[model samples]
Target: MNERNHISIREAIRGRITDGEWAPGAMMPGETDLAEEYGCSRTTVNRALQKLAEDGLIERKRRAGTRVREIPSRQAKFRIPILRHEIEAAGGAYSSRVAFRETLKAPGFIQSRLRLATGARVLRLHTVHLSDGQPYAFEDRWVNIKAAPGVVDAPFDIISANEWLVREVPYSSGDVRFSAMAAGQIEAQALATSLGAPLFTVERTTWLRDLYITTTKLCYRPGYHMRTEL
Candidate 1:
């Protein structure tokens, strides 16, 4: 089915559930019935239901079929800003340099994070982001070679890995963490701050389907803040 039809059918199903036509704990219509109602193939209905399942609107089981949850799961929605946009918004010229880049054996921690086998090789990168010639953020990133093989040839020197990956890879899910930490000697020097100064840090891990994409940690200089409207 077309993308328009897919969206309409998904919205229709969601409307029914939210409007109480399908009450909490109620079983959803079978795929065949839903397809007939939407005048589409079962594949289209399946796709719509899959999206609802992913959004936590419904649950599906192999033998038990699909049902509306007693309570919809809470979902957090936020936009992942591009770094350049954020810098430009602050009225600063954005610039970055590849401080370090290499291909080597994945470390134990990185291997576990990406579920890679022993001796797996990964691409490592360290970057220093600048705003108007002042230090902004320090980036430490690792790319899963098995998942993004083409990254081996990407021109990271010209375009940052963060920007390139965001454009090249389509992620289905990700995890993000934010915290305040005292900058280490290396971090302080890279960020042009005093040693042990407080810095805001963000760690992000992304995946496309089951394939690991990349893991990155961004440590920002003092006074950095992240705000998002719900």
Candidate 2:
């Protein structure tokens, strides 16, 4: 999918953060300055910086202005790896709760994106991610049963599909993308935040050889930040 205007602004801001135009803990340009620089409105700059604040990539305050956060950025690289283990490595207590689960027909968009054949079935999972006791993320995922057959009847009460796949399934390659978006009502509720909250959106397409494995859309909390070092 093509990026929206806010996402384009997000990329530009992320680029500046990555390029050292704004150092850690350094204050950033005001909304008016940024708007003038980007040839957009203050609302657009607000939307972009709001997204960065939500992602925990930057800290914003009234009067004090926005500043590059002192946090490290070693968490944004995609290397076809495991999600559950990644969570564990971050030193946060990782847990998952199933919000919705079903075996359903893949939608036309999903079918085309996953390159599934007609009549193919997909196992769908709607999950909430928890770090310690706080809500962290909401996951909407679809797995190709033809690729991971056991998911058809898999029990998610004890383990998550991500954790299970990392332990049992081996994938060859994957593609991933990230963006910024306003959270819908339901997503905001599940994430324990307010409506229209800014969120970090991550989408991934994974394949095992030529077989499509799974695709997932992950919506992170208003304070979730991802960073990576070169």
Candidate 3:
């Protein structure tokens, strides 16, 4: 009936799978049957099932139908953290500053990363996140203007690009990488640390279906630790 109803159907179906009411390898009911049972349209049921498949909770095959996964993928799921929330959760005040913002042609590396055409225009932003008035992380980000045109007009000075993108953009798929890197001169200045100091770094790229959204590298100050749960 509405978007909320569709979301409820999705959660209901997910509960059945996670609660083992629909055992692993169990065939899901047909979309028509599910729609009738839920008193909704078949399109709504299909949307719910599609989301489950994308989450790896089930497998869907053409003509064969859908079934709960025997072994749900062990994919490491990570939520993109908002620096403000992270700082607040740790009992510190959070703040941010936009160091630089520009619109320019994609560099060679950026073109390769986002799979963009040569000379494609993009929005580049550099920002520093602070916790309790101290440097927390430095962010270097590139946005695909073709994918998110509004980014060019966003006021990064008022709201960090990290926060803005997370709030406004919805990505269908993404990847993340974690590593350690020695701070470069710019990063050193932003984080108030010496160059060559080891820093925890995270790189992320997100896409809305086939459209690349944005890619960012966040370098945390020395002694920063990251934790995630399975």
Clashing residue pairs in candidate 3, if any? none
Task: Residues 101-157, candidate 1: write the lDDT tens digits.
Answer: 899999999998987889988999999999998999999999999888888889987
- Residue pairs in collision within model 1: none
Candidate 3 segments whose C-alpha is farther than 4 A from its true place: 1-78
Error of 1 at 190 (Å): 0.9
| Maximum-lDDT candidate | 3
What TM-score does model 2 achieve against the real structure?
A: 0.63
Determine which window of 10 residues in candidate 1 has minimal summed lDDT.
73-82
The total of clashing pairs for model 1 equals 0
Estimate every model's Cα lDDT from 0 to 1. Answer: 0.88, 0.82, 0.89
**Stretches of candidate 1 exceeding 4 Å from the true structure:** 1-77
TM-score of each: 0.67, 0.63, 0.67
Give lDDT: candidate 2, residue 37. Answer: 90
Candidate 2, residues 81-131: lDDT per residue as tens digits?
355566778777888888988888889988998899988999989989887
